[model samples]
Target: MKLLALDTSSEGCSAALWLDGQITERFELAPRGHTRLLMPMVRELLAERGLKPSDLDALAFARGPGSFTGVRIATGVIQGFAWGLDLPVVPVSSLAAVALSAMEQHQLADGSGVAVAFDARMSEVYWATFACRDGLPAMQGNERVCHPENVSLPDPDTTTDGWFGAGQGWKFVDGMPEAIATRIRSIDTSLVPRASQVARLAIPAFHAGQAVPAEQAQPVYVRDEVTWKKLPGRE
Candidate 1:
């Protein structure tokens, strides 16, 4: 199966094309130019593979739990492309993608769990946990947004094998509880969700008949509601 995927959900912007069983990707850590760079990156990958939007089996994207604008950008772009090509869309979780990256990059063995987190600004984080299954990270719990201090694991018994901490959120927080920290084998503060990883994760979902129409494709912003309090000197 062939698939095209893109992600602009963090400081990085990336596009990946999965043809046959091989993958081609373009990635850039551009914090401000996702809007300008995403399409070109997508086009470049397609061109390299001599494929078009209509030639792909499906389109996938990192759907959310990162920058609001970044998530919206990817959602809108994928929606438009899918609508135009009449193709199914797969929305992969950004946190899950991070976990997949950790698995591949760190060579975490099967059954290893990963605690994925992304700095969500405002002193909060977007976090989730996933266990490696068939070399893929399967989410263990709901993705969520909260202060680092409020973060906790599902259950010690369930995660006793421990999880590898991945993403920038772990860097922002002072530290996790001793129990949790001790369980973590290691932490990768430099990792961010990329399109290549999203596509890899989406392949199974795509084959499982999980794709949706363009209009039904939605971003998963864990923080559904935001409340703001005006500071004394600010509006």
Candidate 2:
């Protein structure tokens, strides 16, 4: 299937074209510049594939548990593109993409496990523990927003050790709770959701008749509703 996917859920903006199992993607860590970079990246990706918006079988994007503006930017762009072409769209979880990428990185087979987290920027982290199955991430615990201190490890008895962790969220955790620290033996600090991964992950959802309306393709901002005040140099 030919699919176009994009992600603007963090420090980077990324877009990709996936056709016949081949993938072409563009990504950059442009921070607040997502507004400027995203569309161009999408255009370039589509242009390289010699395809128009209508040629895509589906459109996919990272649907939050991330930056409010970033998630909105990603979903809004997907909405416009999908709506314009009258195409279906798949909304994949940003944090889920993070975990999937990590699982792929380690070649973790059906029995290994990993923890995924992302610094939520308001003194919290978006966290989930997954059991890696043939390199695919299957949730082994709950997905939630919690302070570093409140984070707990999943039951070790239910899964084997050689625990791996991924994402930038772990950096914010100074000294991990005793629950997670003892078993976490490896960590990959450089992983984040890329447009390529989002597209790859969305293939199943798109083919399974799981696509949603453009307006319903919204974000999953897990932080509290209280607006965070920032200084001129902040935010």
> Which candidate has the top score in TM-score?
1
* Cα lDDT tens digits for candidate 2, 1-235: 8889999998878998999999899999887899999989988988887888878888899987788888888877887777678888899888778878887777776677778888887688888888776556777766789888887766776466467888998896565687677788888878888888898788877777889876567677766573432222322
Candidate 2: segments with Cα more than 4 A from true spot: 224-235
What's the residue-level lDDT of 24 in candidate 1?
Answer: 93
TM-score of 1: 0.92
Q: Residue-wise lDDT of candidate 1 within 1-235, one digit each (tens)?
A: 8899999999999999998889999999999999999999988998997877778889999988888888888988888888778999999999999999999999988878899878888888888988887899888878988888877776766643567999999985465566667778789999999999999988889889888988777888877684222222323
- Give residue 68's error in model 1 in angstroms: 0.4
In candidate 1, which residue pairs clash? Answer: none
C-alpha lDDT (0 to 100) for residue 149 of candidate 2: 82
In angstroms, the error of model 2 at 79 is 0.9
TM-score of each: 0.92, 0.90
Question: What is the lDDT for 29 in model 2?
Answer: 87
Error of 2 at 107 (Å): 2.1
